[model samples]
Target: MPETGYMAAAVAVCTAITWALRALPFAVLSRLRQSPLAAYLDTAMPAGIMVILAAYTLRGADWGAASSAGPTALALAVTVGVHLWLRNAVVSILAGTAACIALTALAP
Candidate 1:
């Protein structure tokens, strides 16, 4: 385990890098508003975000294991049902989490 001070410094460094990666483009583009690069970035950002989200979501997926199927399917069903019924973020999230926990606990 990392020492407390080392962990804090590592977290601070990671946070700084993340912030700089996100902010640098905007800062540069603001100064070059009329550039083609700016227009390209604006149009490409949504697609980039979608690809990143898809990659993140599928990163840990293990299709070879049947163990993940039941709980994941149940949680997905719960999430869809809750969103359809409540249309509220907090309620949907809580309901989904609760349903997942209950289903996981009951699973063989």
Candidate 2:
């Protein structure tokens, strides 16, 4: 077994490192909050993220196969319609997922 003094020193070093790692983000983000880039990202990130998500979700879709693609396309339409009508992302996503599940299950 290691000596008590050595173990205590090791633990102290580890604790300090862990605390620094945890605090670093707050320190960085606090500075970033005043940056123009951060302001731009705050305004632009949501739409950009949504676009990326949509592209990723549809990227692998079998567009040539109507039977496989129809449900996904319909679900996307439902998602957009629900979001437009309700103006709620959570509700729209849930409704779209449910529609996809039901449509795929019913697809022959």
lDDT of 1 by residue, 1-108 (tens): 889999999999999999999988886668787889878887989989976884565455565433355776777678779889889978887887788677767888
Q: Give the poorly placed runs of model 1, Cα more than 4 Å off.
A: 31-67
At residue 17, give the lDDT of candidate 2.
Answer: 99
TM-score of 1: 0.65
Q: Estimate each model's TM-score.
A: 0.65, 0.56
Q: List the residue pairs that clash in candidate 2.
A: none
lDDT of 2: 0.88
